[model samples]
Target: MEYLKVEEGDQREPVSPTGQFLNSEALSLCILGVLELGVPISIDESHMDSLVKDVFLPTNPRFSSIMVEDENGEKLWKRVKVKIKDHIKTPTFPSGLSPKIYDKYIDDYISDIATEKLPVTRPLWQIHLINYPTSNSNAASSMIFKIHHSIGDGFSLIGVLLSCLQRADDPSLPLTFPSVPLSSTNKDSNGLFKKVSRIFSVVTNTVSDFYTSIVWSSLLEDDMSPIRSGVAGVEFRPFSVATVTFSLDHIKQIKSNIGAKTVRVQAKQIQLHWCCSTRGNFAVMFPIKEMIKLDSKTPWGNYFAFLHVPLPKLTDDDSTSYSNPLEFVWKTREIINAKKSSLGVYLTGRLLQVLKILRGPEAAARYIHGTIKNVSMGITNLMGPVEPMTLADHPVTGLYFMSVGAPHSLVTTIMSYNGQLRIAIGAEKGLIDAQKLKSCIEDAFQTILKAACDDDT
Candidate 1:
């Protein structure tokens, strides 16, 4: 358990024992799963060497290092080495292997690797290049990207990876590796103490600053509280899960049309429509409609809520058409907006009940362990191309990434980068046909794209 020096003026202060519980979905997913893809393209050893040396080396910190204190209490960054694993096998699908088999491989790999202990010896990333047999008895290649979460968010990690490529034939260009500082050893006990002291001081200051700011701002802020009103007072029912995707352009257009600033609006529309159509219960909703109202009455923590969105039963005279879909989507957006305007409080008194049970050590352990059984799907959309990325000197054709959540029912991740919109869905073993889900999601995205494009026509 060595510590690293913090660089001056860095926002993150050094902490003892370094690692913290993942607080964001993007970070958690990067740490929890590997990116496995089959590449129809191949390169020589020198090219692979260049990719690893230039691309992998410089971007190592996004997943490898922890912030720690030095004896003097200055901030610094530590770099972790990414791990590489090799498995030689035969390929089967035209894309190099069948999606079903590839997904199974991913499941097994994640089960084997997910853990809390941060690797101390190498960079916190791994690469596996599989050169295996094809169904045609010819060799095919695949690449696996395994990175830890603490280093950077999903977007940043992907950016680092893409930085490794040049144009397909322009490998001769000098590599532009992201600059990183060298790793330094903790040398003495005083260094550790100083780091701890600095961390304590920083935490104290932060709490004080937050308290003062909030107190002063309270005098001038308006009471735009969250409203709890919706098509409530209706019975809730279980609904079947379905997914849809929209082209990046259409998503942008919708955002522009709605004049929304954040993805919360989009997510709310989805929740509203699903509730209206199926009258089903939702486990959770973000930008909780209740948070605004209850901020002063409750603890200032994330206070989301779950409710049932009841749908009207379909009549024989009702027809499913493009008009119907548009109407449903529009109505859902309206309901969400109406709820947003009226303040409503979410009941969080249950949390006290949970805390009471968790007061005991045994009970706390039991509760934490129980999370393994209570998995729920989470949807996170990383909208649009922030930047371009390449790999192995080849322009990226397409990119997709996903993370597996606990209880493992299904977790959907959507990201649009470089003119491509990608979706990755994780499911429990034997619970979902990954191929079918993939197709459904693709179809959904296509449907949305067509609708948007048709509007243009």
Candidate 2:
């Protein structure tokens, strides 16, 4: 196919391999990435209109282009003239509804949109404004950004969102993140014996993990539990979204009390253990383990792979043993460290590339879908700026995001902003109890925090 450019010589390139895997007409496997931001004041449509036309469309050419196929049926991004009004939505509510009713309306509104597919005629994105008082703090308005996963993952999309935001206190200054020190282990060894042993261990573990991935994708699947609906076409099914916020300072205290190396480990430890106890024994699946691999010279696109991280198993006695909850933290740390030492994630990426070359993208998409379909649940996390941010001159009161159209019973997305972590749980609407899941996660956090405090003394 010829690389053609029109009068406007911009954004006429073939879609990346991963992008095709996500958004091909033959196998339309798209992840509708939705981000919800709460604002302290009511939304101004005029300000948002200007932002969409000036700031957003100009930030990335992908935001202004539509995916089209050539004679050979290969997807290419073609620039198009965007109509700002076509992409903006404003839903009205009753005049005198209470805050509680408005909250329910907001949740129902999000689920309604989550199940709908984005049209291919225009740019694959939209913005929704809900100018109603929500029960979450002083959030009188909520802004929803719906973008296709083909444009970018949560990480790069967050960057695009950041481009539209500035420090609420000083728009002249740049946004920053908390100085959380990265944890690393000493690799110094006195003899060749330890080095050789480490290499052998990594090789053995990689082989085992690769084999497990193959089996799980084909023959074996998670058992039918409360969270696993085991239904066909679960991706198209509606899912409920719920959010729970935790103080970063309290998480740090839990880490300090238990002598944990990093706050991330402590936070995930609570979640992994909670899933094992409250829901069922299921491996926590990541549809795209390595979400973004940025090349300094190339523009951002879909660059994601998959991984299956199993939750630590518990026996009947172990399930009842809650006196020492710190063991959960220790076990999770060990499992993560072992995963870091292996090459399973890289191998999975290579395998997908080979499949794309030999069998074609539809097969590759099916393989990817099967990997996600067999799993009971999925989880992903992202980091936000440390300081307060504003969008179109309105202060953001809260921020959280969730991935829709995933073929699973449950998917949890976490993001940290300012000084708190927001955990958004997306679960199958009729099959899973989202509120009960939220309560169980909260219980896990409190259990760990209490145990840490008692042990510190």
Candidate 3:
């Protein structure tokens, strides 16, 4: 954690409380993106280098720095001279890598990058660009960077990516997003539950579920499957990336067939504690662990929570009773529906406060780290732009990313781009085969797509 040789004009800023919390475990968030450039287009490696050096480096000077502990043992950031060659790497693929071979190279590249920790001697990020033919495009290439988790969370990182970009067509025009409100208004607007009714519901429903969750976590673990390593499993394992692509229209069809909105909303309002991991989401019928705190006031840096949701055993015969492809989803809906009214998430938020009060902040942070160690696999679903995006005049066709480490070996990331929803799976190499997991997910999704829409759904 000591500083490397001091550099000129280097300024040190104390790592935020959240950053300190993550630094305790030396975890980093690595973002891997696959950019699709359609047809054949000439790309100068020097131009790409200059673009990052002049545009990207100036836009975020912090990217030209490293994280180190100062004399007082405080986590601090110090600026360093930007090294274009060290930061932007150009990897070449064979002349005839056939789409499949190229894909394998990509998988290997991601897996290798996912296991790499950012060096404290250089900037916290690095981009690896490969001039190769992608299954989606010929001029396409991939850029994978290792970012310290302390640097920022997904939301902030996405913001940074958008900030550097303007409307592809007109560089002068700023990129704008349609203002669509994500969350709903206050419950009072519904004119539904009065104060007295709310009190009664909280006392009866919320209190009861909180007590039940306590009993559950204290007693047993959420099913022990291939993906879940259980309490005794190896906690510190390396990670890898796996990917699967599904039809966006087909997913919507499944949603229509089964009032999926009603299912998710009902689950959220009722006994639900629905949360997501770098991989995916599910009910956390366990103890509270590491969750991001309310510290998003900063312009950019990681201020996020960690929710580890286990993957269900897709090959289990017991889960195949229903004929619909969405049987897994419907079955999951039923399981979560029962606990929709629970106050688990609310109680979880209070856990750190209670611990900080009784045991101290350091103790509370340790408790957070300890609780997340038992988690084995993670799942994430990301929604992206319906239309393609261009970077430096080249259209970006496909994009993807993955979280490097979280004490858990397996992490799953899903992003829907254009007409397809691409699911990227990250797991420890020896612990689980990324290819097998991808196959399982694809098979399950296809099974649902091939089934008929039942009237009951």
Candidate 4:
């Protein structure tokens, strides 16, 4: 892997706090990987140039500027710069093709991006066009995009890219780039009292909002208890063996049947079904409730907790179906409700406190690695149609995003694009067999699709 430094004195700004949180660690890792794959992809020269040029230039806050004190004790945002390397032309892969060749290329690039440091000089993002073999006989390739977590969170980055693109046929017109509006607060002012007051206000609000979330979650609902841990030596796992997709109508029906009072009922059922079907050992389902508590004070991005839904052991003749899954669903709901009191935020704060004590980024890195295995997977469902997405003038047929799996065997990601729900599952290499997981996911999706179709008819 090659490293590029951004030139000193160039100005560029960091994204907002919400954007920073979203673009933070996990998202950043994925972006870096995608950017490394950009070399061989079909990106237009102009688009690529715009990405590098617009993204790297100086900003109001000057992203390269880090706050520090001078010898005389005056404090200021010190600007630092670094250089960037051109794309490597030499073949990073071996001469002949082998089994799972795509995996080799992708994995090698992933590792390279993961280890590379973000340049302090420019905005921390990269774009790489991947030229890779695909199953389609008509088209020989595919494209991947890599971005840094510090640049923007997933949604923010998606929004940024989408803004730059037009429909394929309309691509001839120059796309308009939207400038991010400045925050109301002034950063250059030398008033120490104002700065301190702002910091205090932010902390106070965050703490208050966190407590409020706990109260709402607690008073809101109840779920079943989760399974206790056992001593079984964990086996290495790979991608999911099965996945199921529910149509919008089907999900709505489930909500109507369960409790028409709240949209969360459907989420409850999905989590319950997965927990019971896989047995408690396979994974736990958590409903992300952070979005529901949105208020003026609440954080803008993800601040939800995963309330573990424990599955009951299935008997030999047990049939896993949508109706039966409701039992497990309600149980998980109870767990979520139980923690709705201050306990949820308290626990989270405690965890964050532990993380803080670790000291330094390396400690944070270790913390993430150690925590992945405690849960089997995560699933997020957004209620509405996502804004349409396209690439190189071609409307995207489908898209799904999954974080690279933690130490855990697998993670499943689901989102609705256009009118269709898309799912992507990630798993570790040795733990779960990829083919088996793929088959299982396909089977699950088919089952759900068929069930939805029948219900519609």
Candidate 5:
């Protein structure tokens, strides 16, 4: 790792290994997070200018910088003068349009921008404002933020956004995240034999999983199904984004009845069937949780890695598993627990670092592209503030995000905000019906909720 020297009034920082991989030419990914406002509002370009210059830019220097190669040929962030107007987009829609018409137009606009690559000459981020009443939000306006993955992971970017937002109810009070407990209980009291057995299981599972990841990236690929296109450069294709909302109360009931540990357990259980049902391997992106918990002084960059948690397929012969919601939860829990016990996820991160040093960033990036493309889909979850927050004084009604340019037919992003869970599904246009997928997911949630209620009764 090398850092460029900082002179008086000059700012430059070396790009981390993980950042290099994400921003590489072969695999450039962007995070598209949308903020739905409670009231219709117009964008005051000058006020937004102040917000960006005074508040947002101060949160992270990378927000006002561009990625460039230093004299040593190592990529680094170079601070540059930012024209706030260049980064802010105000999209105009036809006037006197019905709510339904406006909704469709908004969706089309999002899909059109989702597949675009941020310009490297300037900062790799932009904010698009749609100030119109829509049936979907029942609100007057929404804001879509497009930030390059190279700048930071989803969590880091969320933190920066939080700094710019204040509690809608009380601006003086700080926002808080929901407390999710660990699913696994203490097992240190187990007997020596039991401990040894666990160790053996960990080693066995880790080796098997790491090997499977290699094959998935190299020789094997997910089979084409209703949810997967199995086509190269699928990320560049147009994608339709649809969301399904779930009540936190219902999620808690299911967790209590099923003895599940976290909200993700419920989410993954529902997503498992809808995303894929093929014999080929599927992988989900689990962040390196420990790396993401940074102090205030920590610089922002890509700080998380993907865990290739192998997804199981549902075949016609496995009718029992599909029919019994309780049994499905239990099976999903078992798989998640096993993956947690293994070290394959951490080791995979190390392998990428080694590849970066031994080969180069391009080699590592292509490897990442292959690993991501071979999988049927990817899923990510981020917890939002418990209380309502305001962005530039506008009341935020809801929040959700979708990843673009990932080379996968399906990408699911889950966000929990204000006692509700929003699961945004990004599927390739024409290849996968986004609404049908949402229906299946919603049905799955209801089935699980009913089963949990029955079990309680």
Candidate 6:
């Protein structure tokens, strides 16, 4: 195996083996974050270069360099002088463009560019800076990053991207937790029979999980939901992104209504799909703790295995109000807890390892191609700065991002900044309107909120 620092260019290797199977030219993973900075960039060539060389490149090395072709599969990033003008673009909007029109332009722009391949010959990323006068007296601005999926996975990309940001309040502080404090459970005393029972319970759970992962999951076709059918046909299609915002208070409001007083970041997905059957046909959750642990020195790069779960679809029924959501939240908690107690994750990891050795990269890659085509959708939520962040001395008031490519009709990216949760849905336009899904999310939250408000009344 070959190695390279994330900034040093091993974009398509060990960090993410799936990169080898993916389309380098046609499909790309974009980290398009919209920055609503109280301050806007004063576009000038030198300043842009300084921003790139000083602020961006060092933060995520994959940005300034390109990969050199290698045999025996040892990859590395080689640095080239990145021209500021070539990478950063400032596009002017038509005169008298309203904020509403500007908003429309953004949606259209993201859709149009979703399938547009990055220039593979150069470094695999670019940034778009938009600061235009709108119908409102106040002008708006955003910074967009378009990058190849091969470069890094969500976990790595988010860390480095946030590293590039400065706290709007305190530049000296780190964007993420300077150091996350970890907790471990202490062993409790129990009788000898209880200990034996505990061991027996562990063994039985492992056997059951193995049976389900290999037998039940492999044999039974995925169940149909709002997105894909149980036996959904896989196809290569263009994808689009719809960024929607929800209030943080509303999310908590809904959670509290479900009789669960405590909520964690990872549990929100359960809240969305608890009562529904959610399937991950093509997309499976990958366990990456082996490589990217809480204390791993290298924090950037891909490290995941695949697992699938079903989520309940949302509805427009006003009569049911809280019942459905309440059911979902509790069910999600139970299902996710059961999954945690199983050996399915361990089994899948070993299975993929065996596949890689027995079948080789081509065969393994084919499985990814098949799975993504079959499942065609994945959602990942990354929490952003609870406090406002800035870029190049400009205060960023808002931000959201998502990606689109083959075998994926809908890829949802959830991000929260300050007190706002932005649910960005990237999907195939022919199959569904991205806005329709956004409306569903908004409606689901509204009903949950109403339920909570009614309880107060």
Q: Model 4 — TM-score against the truth?
A: 0.55
- Number of the top lDDT candidate: 5
TM-score of 1: 0.49
Ranking by lDDT: 5, 2, 6, 3, 4, 1
How many clashes show up per model? 30, 0, 21, 51, 0, 23
Q: How are the candidates ranked when ordered by TM-score, highest leading? A: 5, 2, 6, 3, 4, 1
lDDT for each candidate structure: 0.39, 0.73, 0.55, 0.40, 0.79, 0.58
Report the Cα lDDT for residue 219, model 6.
56
Put down candidate 4 lDDT per residue, 1-457, tens digits, no spaces. Answer: 1222333453433333323322333322333222111123555566555544454333223233433333432223344552323322222455456425655565555435434544533434444444554222122343444444434334433334444444433555433321223335566754998778766665665565455434322332212123212112222222232223445555556556544334443443353343343433223223333222212232223233334333444554555432444444455555444433223444543554465455533343333333333444444443322344345454554444444423344455555544445444454444455456556555543444345345442
- The window of 10 residues in a row where model 4 has the poorest summed lDDT is 222-231
Comparison by TM-score, 2 against 5, better one: 5
Worst 10 residues of 2 by lDDT: 289-298
Listed in order, each prediction's TM-score against the native is 0.49, 0.90, 0.75, 0.55, 0.93, 0.77
lDDT of 2: 0.73
Candidate 3 ranges beyond 4 A from true positions: 1-10, 39-42, 92-94, 136-139, 166-224, 229-240, 262-299, 308-327, 334-369, 450-452
lDDT of 6: 0.58
lDDT of 6 by residue, 1-457 (tens): 1222344333343324545434332223455655665655675778787767886777666676665545554334556667767777677678666777786676667666655666645677778787753322143666777766666666566556676778878888755431223444336637777788767766777776666555433355455555653233223354456666777776677566666533343335432542333443334343254222222254555555555544444355632653545555565566555555566666765765676678755555555444444553666566666777777777666677675554566677666677777777776656767777777777666665665567543
Please write out the lDDT profile of model 5 over residues 141-215, one tens digit for every residue: 888889888888888877677667888889988777887564564677488888899899999989977887777
Give per-residue lDDT, candidate 5, residue 25: 73
Candidate 5: deviation at residue 2, Å? 21
Task: Give the root-mean-square deviation of each candidate in angstroms.
Answer: 16.0, 3.8, 6.3, 11.7, 3.0, 5.6
